[model samples]
Target chain A: MALLILPIIIPFATAILSLLFRRSAAAQRAISLLGATALLGAAIALLNVVWSDGIQATQMGDWPAPFGITLVADAFSAIMVTLAALTLLATVVYSLADIDVRREAFGYYPLLNVMVMGICGAFLTGDIFNLYVWFEVLLIASFVLMALDGDQAQMKGAIKYVVINLIASTLFLVAAGLLYGLAGTLNMADLAVKLRDVARPDLVATVAMLFLIVFGIKAAVFPLFFWLPDSYPTPPAAISAIFAGLLTKVGVYALIRVFTLIFVQDVAYTHTLILVIAGLTMVAGVLGALAQTEFRRVLSFLIVSQVGYAVMGLGLYTSGALAASVFYIIEDVVALQCLFLVSGVVYRLNRSENISVMGGIYRTYPGIALLFLIPALSLAGFPPLSGFFGKLALLQSGLAVEQYAIVATALVVAALTLFCIGRVWSDAFLKPSPAPGSAGVLVRSAALSSSRAQMIGMLIPVVVLVALVIGIGLLAEPVFGLATRAAEQLWSPSDYIQVVLGEAL
Target chain B: METILAFVVGGLFAAGLYMMMRRSIVKLIIGLALLSHGVNLLIFTAANLTRANPPIVPDGAKQPLPPVADPLPQALILTAIVISFAVLSFALVLLHRVYQAVGTDDIDRLKPVDE
Candidate 1:
């Protein structure tokens, strides 16, 4: 019970402390690091408890299950909490070097921790209405983070982001309200039980579609993703990396949770709709990536495409497919964070994000090039990397289900993803230096201004993340097994309901 | 009462959507505000309306009486109102800062970030 609440509490406390120490940059940094470390520890501990002890649930204020707000952790929620903590730690370390001092003093660390708290809250909350509250918590935090610099591009990007996201929030509120009207309860497990018995399954399905659209916007699936490429590249690389890594996946996580747990009555209609969206998302996102010439923009589009693979797993609606989706989400989060951080370093060197003007990174900083290469290749689903196993699992599950259409789309998208990454490689890394307007000769001179301490601060997180990715690849069996276990837990909602509401229900 | 509020909610939603589609940034903020208000009302009505009876347990009772109002929807609306208030205020400030920085209130005048 105590374990279930610690992940949310640790980050909430960290954010408060960081906010109080905002005037002192050094103190803020120290507090932020300590907080992230503690969060990761709490998350891992929680995961350990969930792994061995089945599922854990605790109601707020000692209130009983159906009427009170409950926090619950199954294998899936625990794993997500752990992954979020890991990403938070990496982003905090990277921010030490990547974020300017002015931004740090402007409450960056506090907002970051608060955002993580919101994310962990979203993962752990067993109440549907509480889930919406967490979404707003993270949404508001991210809104500030998006416009933290208040520059022209950031502001412009943030406006679109805020407007579209606000609309999604309102829709989510409506969905939750209507759901309450239907189920007479806000607890997710209770909703699952009641929704299954609701006489009008059609109304339940309509509400389910409302949820799909709401989370789909948050996930940036196809036809709903234009705002993503525009806004994601505008933030600082550390901010961008964390947002890219965890934000949409939360949307995906919610989709998986509600669909698997509460909205299973009409899977034939809803899951099929999701399958179509998944295929379209993959095709459209990769195509968008193929069209972009900017470094960060390409990465932004790739994020949209990668989200499709996770959604496809949910769409496949099998235990194996869901496990594959969970595995892919893990690999994608780490790789995307590393790739964005690499983009930050490269942008710092070249002073431009344009691929046409950027060159000589491979020759000048082979380590940086390798850092970029490993993740980029992994994202492209190359063999011997974690991405390969993630994709292979997804494809195997797809084939097993005879979902040849989406499987075929996944393959073509994979090939195109490789091509896009190659384009970035050749233009930004392998090509010889362009004329000395700014990129080539200036890179070496720019290196001098960035203190060695800053460089260490930057490279450490990148190295750690890359190493983690490679470790996952090498140890794919254990990691995949863990994901499979999570998928098994998700496949049986009865276990979730039984644990959360106890046998009384 | 539910039927009346349902139409009012639909009307508010329409007005909000229309305002949002306008090219002016201020209208966008107003639209956002209206939309949230509409959602609050939607929740209020959707939860099944009750009379003025309060959702309080009497001195000796363990739970509220059978005919008492359902307090859950009101609580949900209260929370939603606070959140939307925060978000709308932030959006307004953001719009103001955006105008100051970009020197435009016309949404189309702001250059696309992709450029």
Candidate 2:
């Protein structure tokens, strides 16, 4: 039980300590960094335990499965917990030099830790209501983080973010209520068995649609992603990096969990809709990126586009496809965060995020430029990076099923993604600095740090993440193997239920 | 009661949606508040309401008495109410901060500020 709840407890405890130390920014940072390290340690422990022990679950207060809240960490959930912790670690490391004193005093570190708690909790919970609770926890923390600085842009973005997510949360709440009423239970494993035996299967499908809309908004699928690009680009880059890396992926994780675990009865309708949305999300997000000149905005759009790949895996509903999606998310969480952090570095160096106005950064900081190139190319699905193998697996799986239209859409979007990435690279990193009196000309020289220590504080996390992006790519076989095993677990969810609800159920 | 509540919920949702689309930040917050109320009411209504006594176990009783107002929906709605309250307050405070910073409640004006 301690092993199961340790991920949540560590962060929640860390957050409380971080908030208490908010007066001294250095203390807060140190506390949070320690908390993040502990969080990572706990996640690794949970992962190890789950690996050797099969699914580790502890019913809260020992009330047994269907009655009490159950925290369960299977291979998939354990992987996500570990990923969330790692993202928290990177955000803590990167924020040291970036997050200003005022924002730090506003308890930014605590909010980030709390948000990580919510993410890991969402991943590990075996009860649907607990999932909703965790989502709200993360959403609330994200709202605070998104509006941390309370500047015009941050507030404006946060308003849209809050309102839209409020709508989605309301929808989620309604669905949860209705699902509970229908099945007389909100325990996910129990509901899995109970939903299968429900009298009105169509009602289950209706509730399933509600879930799609809810998770769709969170996942920022096609036609539901307006809030993401609007909100994501305005936050501080460390905040944006964490948001870009983890928030939507939590939604994606929820979609995968609910769709694969509980709502499989209507796969024909639900999965096909997911596939369609996946293709459109890819196209829409990349096209949106192409039209933008802002660094974080382009990255935000790519984040949306990449989610489509994960949703596409869910849409394919095959073990191979699902495994690919799992691998894709892990790859994305690492590299996308690196890119966002690199954008921060870009802005930090040149005092601008407008790629058109950004130049000579590459001239001054070759290391930073290299940091940008790795994730940028990886996100563009360049060969020998993590994204390449993930995309290849997704493409192979799609082709195996002969989903030509969606597959073709994926191919076109991939090409467009590369084009957009190239556009960013050429405009921001490669092109010569524009002359005075030129369009979007910038006079700001690269702020080669007066404080090299602060520069290293920010730069090292990006470098570490860049190394990770390369590491996952080079070690693809073992990673993909783990993903496949996780996928196999999803394919046979009965074992999950048996573990949670026991054999009789 | 359920029938009346359903219509009221729909009305609130529509009104909230309308207000949310307005260009004013204050209106946006109001809309969010309305939507919050609407959703709480929705949870109450969607779960098959009953007009029975409050669900409290009697002395020596193993479970709550039958038809005791289906306490689960009430419990769910209670939680929703608390969460929505927290969110609404935060939204309001955030809007207040925006107004103080930008000196405007108009989202159209705030639009350019984002860039």
Candidate 3:
């Protein structure tokens, strides 16, 4: 339990230190790196502890449950925190070379550290209202990061991003307020216990529905997802990669935690809505990807599509399905970050994100192309990749539930994902250079100069992430076992509530 | 009283949504402000609108008491108000920057090349 809290505390303290030493770029970088590395260590230690000791919980300030905020670390949150720590560490390394270190010294490292703290806190928090505070922490950090450059594209994207999220935050607050009003407590565990015994069950259902809306907007579900594609690609690659890899997953994690614990009975209605949304999200996202001619835009759209798979697993509501959803979330985050990193390298090489202006790069940068291809293929659900296993698990669960239409739609969408990625691969790597007339129109071709060090910095992380994806694919049984345990824990609700509110409650 | 508050907040919410859907950046900011107000009110109303006294205990009060406003909701709303103000100011600066860079407040005009 003590180890579990370190991920949140280390980043938070480092954020303050970084701000205090904001005038010195070197100090800021050192503090940020030290903080991130410490968090990585803490996450590993916590994972090891959980592996040995089952689950861990800590009551803040030594207060009993229903009165104090609690931090709980189970298998699901532990894995997520570990992944988030690793991703932030990689992004920090990438930012060292990518960002203007001196100009960004005051705000960049501090905000990033705070964002990581927010993500870790959200993952670990056991109280519903405290989760809202964590969400605000994440949001405020992200708002600053998105507008970091103050460029036209970033400013436009930031406006839409902030507005949409503010609305979602408002909805979340309303839902939390209602839940507290009804249950007479804001702790998630106590609410879960009280909710199960409530006489006015309809009110609980209504609040749950509102929560779904709030989290759905954050998670970028179908109708609520329009802002994502427009906004994500405009930011700097490191910021975009972290946002792509971790932010929405936090929302999905919240959905899984809340619905599975407190709103199980409403699943019949909610899961159906989720199923419909999943199918549409998958299809619409891939269609958007297909229509895109730019590398980053395509990846952004694909993120929408990939998130559908995680939601699909949850919507199916079987134990197998929920486990698969967890697996999908992990794989998607790793694979998506790899893709974005590779896209950054590609943009650096070609001087543009437009696929039309890129060709024959494989001749000069075969290693980078290979790195990009791994995640791209994995994303398409290719055999022997982590993405394949995630989708297969989802398909099996959907079939078991006799959701034939969803299964069929998923198959088609998977094929479309492959085709879209293949289009990118062919245009950006395999094809000959464009004709001279077309080549002349390309902007700043001089920017295509590639450095071995930059490629190494980018490619190493991509290769390691892809390798992990493949490893997870091969070791699906054990991974699935962990996810199954998590899903079972989610379904039971008793251990979580008891740990937070005491067994007597 | 609760139903009327809901109706008013819902109306504000709908107006905010409509304004947010517009392409004008200024309207979007106004919309967000309205929406936050509506949400704050919604959270306030969720606590059932207490009257007669503040949540603070009087000097002569005993261990237990009734007819007091829920302090939790008030605290949450206060925090939310601070957060929304920060976000609103940030949005205002961002909008100002966007206007200068793109020379237009229309979102449609500011579309990036890759978009």
Fnat values, one per model, are 0.80, 0.63, 0.63
Best by TM-score: 1
C-alpha lDDT (0 to 100) for residue B15 of candidate 1: 96
Evaluated on the second chain alone, the candidates' TM-scores are: 0.90, 0.85, 0.88
Q: Could you tell which candidate, 2 or 3, scores higher by lDDT?
A: 2
- lDDT against true structure, model 1: 0.91
**DockQ scores of the candidates:** 0.80, 0.62, 0.60
Alpha-carbon local distance difference test for all models: 0.91, 0.87, 0.84
TM-score of each: 0.97, 0.96, 0.94
- Number of the top candidate by lDDT? 1
Predicted candidate 1 versus true structure: per-residue lDDT over A1-505, tens digit per residue:
7888888899899899988887899999999899999999999999888888888898898888999999999989999999999999999999988898778978999999999999999999999999999999999999999999667888888999999999999999999999999989999999988987898888898899899999999999977899999899988899999999999999999999999999999888889999999999999999999999789999999999999998999999999999999999999999999999988888887877789888888988888999999999999999999999999999999999898999999999999999999999999999986877753332212432567788788999999999988999999999998899899989998888998898559
In terms of lDDT, the poorest run of 10 residues in model 3 chain A is A439-448
Better of 1 and 2 by lDDT: 1
Predicted candidate 3 versus true structure: per-residue lDDT over A1-505, tens digit per residue:
5786899999999999989988888888888889889999999888777766766889899888787889998878888999999898878887765666533754899899899999999999998888998999999899888878666677778777887898888889889888877887888877777887798889988998899899999999898888898889877787888999999899899988887877876678988888898899999999999999878889999999998888998789888888889989988998998788778777787777779878877887787788888888888899998899889989999999999999999999999999999999999988876665574344533434446776676666667777887898888788888778777777676777766676548
Please report, as a residue range, the 10-residue window in candidate 1 chain A with the lowest summed lDDT.
A439-448
The CAPRI-style docking tier of model 2 reads medium
- What residue runs in model 2 are displaced by over 4 Å at the alpha carbon? A436-450, B51-54, B61-64, B67-69, B112-115
Task: Give residue A93's lDDT in candidate 2 (0 to 100).
Answer: 93
